[model samples]
Target chain A: MIWAVALSAGALVASGAYLALSRDALRAVVGVSLIGAGANLVVLSAGRLDAVMPAFVPEGASRLADGAANPLPQALVLTAIVIGFSLTCFALALVMTIRQRVGDTDSTGLRAAEPPAGADGLPAFPDDER
Target chain B: MNADLTSLVVVAPLLVPLAAAVASTVSAGRPRVQQAIGLGGAILLLGSALVLARAVAAAGQVRTALGGWDAPFAIEFVADGVGASLVVLAAVMGLTALLFQQDDTDPAPASPAFVPLVHAFLAGACGAFLTGDLFNLYVWFEVVLIASLGLLVLGKERRHLDGALTYFVLNVVGTLFVLVGVALVYAATGHLNYVAIAHATMADPYRVLPFVAVLSVGFLVKAGAFPLFAWLPATYHTLPAPALALFAALGTKVGVYALLRTGGAVFPTVAPLMSDLLGWVAVGTMVTGVLGAAYHWDIRRILAFHSISQVGYILLGIALGTPGGAQGALVFALHHSLVKGSLFLIAALVCREAGSYDLRHIGGLSSARPWLAALFLLQALSLVGIPPLSGFWAKFLVVRETLVLGHVVWAATALAVGALTLYSMLKIWLEAFWRAHPREDWQPPPGARPASAIAAAGLAAVTTAFGLWPEPVLRFTFMAATVLHTRP
Candidate 1:
C-alpha cells in the first residue's frame, strides 16, 4: 500500500512537471494543481500506514492505543488541501483575466511589458533612424 | 501591562494589518474609510513593533503559543531580535507605502480595494517574520501571493494581466516546493517547530541536509536569486510607482528573512555543501542581475534588475556564515529595503514628470525639479556604494567579510557589480534628469500629487540616517547575528 501510494505521488509530480512546460496558461494551472495534489499525498503518506485503529482515545483515557495512526500528517494534509484550493482559485482567475485580455491562453503573445530584442526591433525609440 | 498583553504586542504586527484588511472589506465602497483604517492601523502597528523589538532586546526571545499547548504541538510564534527588528522594518515600510498610496491617484473610480490589498500584503510580511512554524510561513506566503497579485492585476490592462499571471504561477510553484521540503523534514524529524527541529537536525545532520537544501532552493527562488529571478523584473515593472515601491521594500526581503531564519538555524546540517552551493550561486546571481540591469533602458526595469542584484549581496553574506558575514547581510538588507524602495518611488515620480520611463526620451529634470533630482542622485550614489552612504557601509562589511573568508573571486565579483550598479544609476541620472527634457514642455500626469515626493524623500532620509549613524543598525544586526547561534 505504501509503495503504491508513493509511486502514484511520484507519477503525479512527474506528469505535473511535464504539463507545466506547455504554453497554455490553463495547462500550467492544472499542472500546479496536480503538483499540489501530489504534495498532499506525499504529506499524507509520510505518516505510518500500518494501523488497526483510528486516531482516538476513549473518554477518561490518558493515552492512545499503541497501534494508532500518526494524526499529524492527516491534519497537515487537510491544511494543504484548503491552501492549495485557494491558490488554484487565484491561478485560475489570473488565467481567466489573461484570456479576457489577450483573447488567447497562449503565453507567447504576452510580451507587452518587456522590451523587444535589439536585433528584432528597429530601435528602442521611434525617432532613431535605423 | 501583563504577560498576555506583552504577548499580544508581539503578535500585533500581524493582527493590526489583518484587522485593517478585514475592516476595509466591510467599508469596501469608501476609499477614505479604507485609507483611514490602513494608515491608523499602521501607526498602531509601528508602535507595537517598537515595543516588540524592545521586549525581544530585553529578553533573549519571546514565544507566544496559542491554546496553551506545548510549542511543537500548537500554533506558535517566536520573535528574536531578527524577527522583531524585521517587524519594525515592515511597519515602517507599511506606513510609508500608505503615505505614497494617499498621493497615488488612479484614473478609475476610487476603489477601497487598494488599501485592503496593501494591508493584506503587510499582514503576510509581518506574519511570516514572526511565525515559528514552517507551515505557518507557507500560509503567509499564500496571503502575500494572493494580495500582491490582486494588487498587480488591479488594472485591466493586458500587460498587467501578463505580469501578474507570471508572478502568480511561479510563486505558487515555489510555495509548493517549500511544502514538499517541509513535509519531508517533518517526516524525518517528527517536529515542525524551529527549536525542536534544531535539536533533531543536530542529532542527524545527514538526514536533514537534503530536505533543508530543498527548502533553501525554494527560498532562493522566492528571493529572486540567479536562474529564477526573471519573474521579478518581469512583473515588478508592471506595478504602479507606489505599489512597486511597497513591493520593492517588502517582497523579496520577506523571502530573505525566511532564508536567514531557516538557513541560519540549520547551518549545521547545511555546512558541508553550503560553500560550493551558495558561493557560486551568489556570484552568478550578482553577475547575471547586474548584466540584466546594464542591458535595460526602461527606468523601472533597471531598478527591478538592480533589486535582484542587491539581493545577491545579502545572500553572499549569508552564504559566508560568520558573525561579520551575518551582520553584513542584516545591515545590507535594512539599507536595501529603504534604498531600493525609495529608488523605485523616485522612478515613478520621474516617469510621471517626464512623461516617459524610457531613458531615450526623458531628460533635463535637474534644471527644473532640482530637489527631486538631488534625491535621485543621493539615493542612486548610495545604491552604488559611494562613500558615507548607507550602501557603502553595507558593501564594506559584506566585502570585508567575504575577503576575510578567502572567497577572492566573490569579493571581486561583488566589487565589480558595484561599479556596474553605479553605471546603471548614472545612465538613469544622465538620461532621466540631466541630459535634456525629452520634450521642452513636459507636464506631470493628471492627478499626480506632491505627497509621493515627500514620502519618498522621507524614506531616503531614513536611509541617509542609517549611513550617518551606523552604530545602532550595526548593533542591531550584530545582535540578530548572534541570536542565530555563535558558530554552533
Candidate 2:
C-alpha cells in the first residue's frame, strides 16, 4: 500500500510539474492543483496504512484497539484540501481576468509587469511607449 | 491547568484579526465601518501582543495544547520572546498599513475587501509565529499567502496582475515544498510537533538530514535569498503603497523568523552542519540583491531589491548558528522591519509627489519637502548602518559576531555589502530627491499630503529612538536570543 501510494504521488507530481512549466497560465493552475492533491495523498498515507479499522474505540473503551487507523492525518488532509481548493479557485479567477484584460493566457505574452531587461546599464519598461 | 489564561492571551492576537476580518466583511458596504473595524482590530492585536510578550517573558514557554491534548499528540501554540517580539511588531506594521491607506483625496476609495484581507493576513502571520506544530505552520503560511494574494490584486490593473501572477506562482511552489518537507519530516520522526521533532531528529541526526534539507528550500525561496528571488523584484514594484509597506514590515521576515524558530528549537543539532553552506548563500544573496537594486532606476523596485539584501544580512546571523549570531539576527530583523517599512512608505510618498516611479522622471524633492528628504535620509542611512542609528548597532552586532566565529570571509562580505547598500541608498537620494527636476513642467501630483505621513514619521521616530536608546532594545533581543537557544 505504501509503495502504491508513493508511486502514484510521484506520477502525479511529475505530470503536474510538466503542466506547470507550460507558458499557458491555466495549464499552470491545473498543474498546481494536481500537485496539491498529491501532497494531500502523501500526508494521508503517512498516518499508517496497515490498519483497516476506523480510528475509534468501542463505546465504553478507553482507546482504539491495535491496528486501528490514525485519524490525525485525515484531519490534516481535509484541511489541506480546503485551503488548496480556495487557492486554486483564486488562480482560476485571476487567469480569467488576465485573459480578458491582456487577451493572452500565455505567460510569454504577460511581460507588462516585467519588461525585457534594458541595455547594459539602464532599465526599460514594456509599456514605456504609452 | 494553570496555562489556560496564558493560552487565551497567546491566541488573542490571532482571534482579534480574524474577528476584525469577519466584522469588516459583515459591514462591507460601509467603508467607514470597515476602516474602524480594521484599525480597532490592529489596536487590539497590539494589546494582546504586549500581554503575550510579558507573559512569555516571565514563563519560559506559554503552551496551549488544543482540545486538552498534550505536546506530541495535540496541535499547540507556543510563544516565547522571539515570537512575541514579532507578534508585537506585526501589530505595529498592521496599524501603520491601515494608517498609510487613510487619505481623503486618494482616487480609489478603500476597497471593502482590503481592510478585511489585511486583518486575515495578520492573523496568519501571528499564527505562523506562535504555532509549535510543524503542520500547523504550513496551514498558517497558506492563510498568509492567500490573504496577501487577495490584498495584492485588490484594485490593481493589468500590469500589476502580471506581477501578481509571478508572485503567486513562486509563493505557491514555495509552500508546496514546505508541505512536502513537513510530510517527509513526519515520516522520518513520526511526529509533527516542533519540540518532539527536535528530540527525534536530534537523537538520530542522520535520519533527518534529507528532510531538513528539503525543508530549507521553502525558507530560502520565501526569504527571497539569491537566485530564488527574481520573483520578488518582479512583483513588489507593482504593489500599491499600503501593500508594499505591509510586506516590507512583516512578510518576508516571516521566512527569516521561521528559520530562526525551527533551526534554534527543533533542529539545533543539525543546524551547524549547514552553517558553512548557509554562509555562502548569505554572501551570494547579499551581493546579488544589492547588485539587483543598483541596476534598477525606479524608486520602489530599488527598495524592493534592497529588501532582499536586508533579509540576507539577517540570514547571515542565523547562518552562523551561534547565540550571539541569533541575537544579532533578531535585533537586525526588528530594526530592519521598522527602517525598511518606513523607507518604503517614503518611497510611496515620493512616487505620489513626483508623478512617476521612474527615477529620471522625478527630482528636486529635497528642495520641495526638506522634512521628507530628511526623514528619507535618516532611515536610508540607518538602513546603510551609519553610527548613532538603529542599523549601525544591528550591523555591528552581526559582523562582530561573525568575526568572533573566525569566519573572516563572511565578516568581510557583511561589511562590503553594507558599503554597497549605502551606495544604493545614495543612488535613490540623488536621483529622486537631490538632483534638479528633469522637466520644468513637472510638479508633485496635485493633492494635499495625507496624515499618513505621520505614520512614516512615527516609524522613523521609533527607529531613531531605538538607535538613541540602544540598551533596552539590545537587552530585550539578547533575552530573546537566550530564550531561543535555551528552549528551541
Candidate 3:
C-alpha cells in the first residue's frame, strides 16, 4: 500500500511538472493544481497507512490506541489542501484574466510588462514614442 | 515582564497588522477611513515591535505556545533577537510604505483592497518571523503569497496581470516545494517544531539533509537567488512604487531570514555540509543579479536585480556557518531593506517629476529637483557601499566574515559584486539625474507631494545614522548572532 501511494504521488508530480512547463497558461495552471494534489497526497502518506483504526482515544483513555492512525499528518494535509486550492483558484483566475486582456493564453505571449528590445537593444518603453 | 504580558508582546507584532487588515477590509470602500486605519495600525505595529524587541532583549528569547498547549504539540511563536529585529524591520517598512503612498496621485484607479492587502502582507511577514514551528512558517509564507498576489493585480492592467501570472506560477511552485519539504521533515523526525526537530535529528543529522535540500530550494526561489529568480525582475517592475518598495524591503529578506534561522540555528550540524554549496550559490546570485542589473534600463528592474545581488551577500554570510557570519547577515539584511526600500521610494519621486520609470525617457532631475537629486545621490552612494553609510558597514561585516572563514574566492566575488553594484547605481545617477530629459520641453509635474520625499529622506537619515554610530546596532546584531548560534 505504501509503495502504491508513493508511486502514484511520484507519477502525479512528474506529469504535473511536465504540464507546468508547457507554454499554454491554462495547462500550466492545471499542472500547478496537479502538483499540489500530489504534494497533498505525499503529506497524507507521511503518517503510516498500515493502521486501519481511526485516530481516536477510547472513552477511558488518556491517549490514542497503539494501532490508531497518526492524526498530525492528516491535519497538515488538510491545511495544505485548503491553501493549495485557493492558490490554484487564484492561478486559474489569473490565467483567465490574461486570456481576456492579452487576447491569448500563451505564457510567452504575455509580455506586456516586458516589451521587446528596440533598435538600440534596450526595452522599448511603451510611452516613449509619445 | 509578566508571563501573560510577555505572551501578548510576543504575538503583538503579528496581531496588530492582522487586526488592521480586518478593520481595513471592513471599511473597504471608504479609502480615507481605510488609510487612517492602516496608518494607525502601522504606528501601533511599530510600537508593538519596539516593545517586543525590548522584551526579547530583556529575555534572550520570548516564546509562547498557543492555546496553552505544550512545546512539541502546540504551535509556537518565538521571538529571539533575530526574529524580533526582523519584526521591527517589517514594521518600519510598513510605516514607510504607507507614508510613501499617502499623497501620491497615480492615473491608475487605486484599488480599495490595497491597504488591507498591505496589512495582510505585513501580518504574514511578522508571522513567518515569529513562528517556531516549520509548518506554521509554511502557512505564513502562503499568507504572504496570497496578499502579494492580490496587491500585484490591483491595477487590473494587462501588464499587471502579466507580471502577476509569472509571480503566481513561480511562487506557488516554490510554496509546494516547501510543503513537501515540511512533510518530509515531519516524516523523518516526527516533529514540526524547530527545537524538537533539532533534538530529534541530533544523533544523525545527515538523515535530515535531503529534506533540508528541498526546503532550501523553496527558500532560494523566494530569496530570488541565481537561476531561480526570473520571477522577481519579470514581475516587480509592474507594481506601483510604494507597493514595490514594501515588497522590495521585506519579501526576499524573509526567505534569507528563513535560511538563517533553519540552517544557522536549528540544524547547525548540517551547516558544514551545506556551507560550500550555499557559498557557490551566493557567488552565482551575486554575479547573475549584478549582470542582470547592468542589462536593464528601467530603474525598477535595475533595483530589482540589485535586490537579488544583495541577497547574495547576506547568503554568503549565512553560508559561512559562524556566529560572526550570522551577525553580518543580520546587519546586512536590515541595512539593505532600508536602503533598497528608500531607493525605490526615491525612484517613485523621480517618476513623478520626470514622467517615466525608463531611465532613457526620463532625466534632468539634477537640474530641476536638486533635493530629490541629493536624496537619490545619498541613497545611490550608500547602496554602492560608500563610507559612513549603512551599506558600507553591512558589506564590511559580511565580506570580513567571508575572509575570516578563508573563502577567498567567495570574498572576492562579493567585493566585485559591490563594484558592479556601484556601476548600476551610477547608471541610475548618470541617466536619471545627470543627463537632460529626453523630451526637450519637459517640465516637473505640478502639485508633486513632499510626503514621499519625506519618507525617503527619513530612511536615508536612518541609514546614515546607523553607519556613523554603528555600535548599538552592532551590539544588538552580535547578541542576535550569539542567540542564533546557541542551540535552544
Candidate 4:
C-alpha cells in the first residue's frame, strides 16, 4: 500500500512539474493544486501503513498499540492542506488580475514591466503627459 | 509538569502576533489603533524573548513539550541558547520594522496592513526558530511565505507585481521541496519529532538522502543561494519600506537557523559534505550577488541584490562545519539582521526625500540632510565592515574561524568578497550622496529628513554598543554555538 501511494505521488509530482512549466497561467495554478494534494496524501501515508484505525485509543486500551495509526500526521496534513488551499486561491486571484490588466495569461509572455536598464528616473504616468 | 510554562515563550511569540494581526484586521480603517496593537505585541514579544534569553543563560536549556505530551510525541518547543538568541534578533527586527512603519508615509497607507503582516511574519519566524520538529518548521515556513506574499501585493505597484510573480514561483517551488523532504523523512523513520528522527537517521543514515535532498532544496533556495536567488533582487525591491525592513531582518534567517539546527543537531556526520557543497554555492552566490549589486543604479535594487551576497558570508561560515565557524556564523547572522534591516530602511527614507531610488535622477543630498547623510554614511561604513563596528567583529569571527579550520583558501575568498562588498557600498555612497546634483524641480516632502536618522540611530546604537562591549552578545553567541555543536 505504501509503495503504491509513493508511486502515485511520484507520478503526480512529475505531471505537476510538467504543467507548472507550461506557458498558460491557469495550467500552472492547476499544477500547483495537484502538487499540494499529492504532497498531503504522501505525508498522511507515512504514518504506519498497517494501521486499520485512527490513532485514538479507546478507554482502558494500551497506548500506541501495535496496529493503531499515528494521528499527528493527519493533523499536520489537515493544517497544511488548508494553508495550501488558501495560497492557491490567492495565487489564482493574482493570476486573474494580471490577465485582466495585461490582457494575457501566458506565463512566458508576461514581460517584466521594468524600464530599460539605463532609463532616467521614474517616468510620469502617461496621463500626466498632457 | 509545570515545565509547560516554558512553552509560553515559544507560544507568545506566535500567539501575540496572531492576535495582533486579527485585531488590526478588525479595526481596518483605524491606522493608529493598528499601529499601537502591533507595536504593543512586538514589545511584549521582545520582553518574552529577553526573559527566555535570561532563563536559557541561567539554566542549561528550557524545554516545553506542547499539548501536554512529552518529546518525540508532542510538538516540542526548545529554548536552547541558539533559539533564544534568534528570538532576540526577531524581537529587535520587530521593533525596527515598527519604527519604519510609523515614520513612512507612502501614498497608499502601508501601515494599516503592514502592521498585521509584520506581526504574522515575525511570529512565523520565531516559530521556525523555536520548534523542535521538522513538520512544524515547514508550517512556519508556509506562514512566513503567506504573510510575505500578502505584503508583496498590498502596495499596488507594477514592478512589485512583476517581482512578486517571480518570487512567488521560486518560493512555492522551495516550499514544495520542503514538503517532499518531510514526507521522505517520515516514511523512512516513522517519526516527525527532531530527536526521534535524529536517532532513526543515525541508525540508517543512508536512508535519509532523499529527504535531505528535498529539505536542502527548500532551505538553500530560501537562503538565497546561487542559481536559485534570481527572484530576490527584483522581489525585495518591490516591497514597501516596513515590509522590506522586516524581510531584510528575519525572513532569510529562517533558512539559516533551520540549516544550523538540522545540520548540527540531527545529522552531524553528513554535515561536512553538505557544507562543502553549500560553500561552493556560497561562492557563486557572493560573486553573482556582488556583480549584480554593482550593475544596479537604483539604490533599493542594489541593496536587494547585496542582501543575497551578504547571506553568502553566513552560508560560508556555516559550511565550515566547526564549532568556532558555527559561532562566527551565528554572530554574523545576528549582526547582519540588524545591519541589513537598517540599511534597507535608510534606503527607503532616501527614496522618500529624493523622490526616487534611482541614483541617476537623485544627487547631492549631503548638504540638504546632513543628519540623514551622516546616518547613511555610518550604516554604509558598518556594512563594509569598518573597524570598531559590529560588521567588523562579525567578519573577524568568520575569518578567524575559517583560518583556524585550515580552510585558508575559502577564508581568502571571503576576504576578497568583503573587499568587493565595500566597493559596492562605496559606489552607492559616491553616486547617491557625494555626486553633484543637477537642480531638479523636485523637493523632499516635509519630515523626510529625519527618517534615516531614526532608523540609522537605532541600528548604530546597537552595533556600536555590541562592538565596543562585545562581552555580553559574545557570551550569548558562544552559548548558542555550544548548544548546537555539543552533543547531548
For TM-score, the strongest prediction is: 3
Which of candidates 1 and 3 reaches a greater lDDT?
3
Per-model C-alpha lDDT, please? Answer: 0.81, 0.84, 0.88, 0.78
lDDT of 3 by residue, B340-407 (tens): 99998888778778887778788999999999999989888888899988888999999998998798
* Interface root-mean-square deviation, candidate 4: 4.2
DockQ of 1: 0.37
Q: Which stretches of candidate 1 lie over 4 Å from their true place?
A: A115-130, B104-109, B441-448, B486-488
lDDT of 2: 0.84
Is model 1 an incorrect, acceptable, medium or high docking prediction?
acceptable
lDDT of 2 by residue, A1-130 (tens): 8999999999998898998899999999899888888888888887877887998888988989888988877888888889989999989999999999988799998887766654111122222322
Can you write out model 4's per-residue Cα lDDT over B1-488, one digit (the tens) per residue? 25557667556666777787888788769877877788888888889888888888988578778777777888888878888888888988888777756653433354467777888898899889888889889999999999999888875555555656767777888887788788778878778887787777775566687678778878888888888886687677667676777887787899888888888787766576577788888778777888888888878778878888888888888888887778888888888888888887777666666666788777677866677788778777777888888888898998898788787777887888788888888887777678766565655667543443565578767877887788899888888888787776
**lDDT-sorted candidate list, best first:** 3, 2, 1, 4
Q: Could you give the candidate ranking by TM-score, starting with the highest?
A: 3, 2, 1, 4
Q: Is the docking of candidate 2 incorrect, acceptable, medium or high quality?
A: acceptable
Judged by DockQ, which candidate is best? 3
Better of 2 and 3 by TM-score: 3
Clashing residue pairs in candidate 3, if any? none
After TM-score superposition, what is the CA distance of residue B20 in candidate 4 from its true location, in Å?
A: 1.5
List candidate 3 segments past 4 Å from native: A118-130, B105-108
Query: What is the alpha-carbon lDDT for the whole of candidate 3?
Result: 0.88
Weakest lDDT window of 10 consecutive positions for candidate 3 chain B:
B102-111
Per-residue lDDT over A67-90 for candidate 1, one digit per residue giving the tens place of the 0 to 100 score: 888888899889889989987887
Model 4 residue runs over 4 Å out of place are A48-50, A54-59, A112-114, A119-130, B1-4, B104-107, B440-452
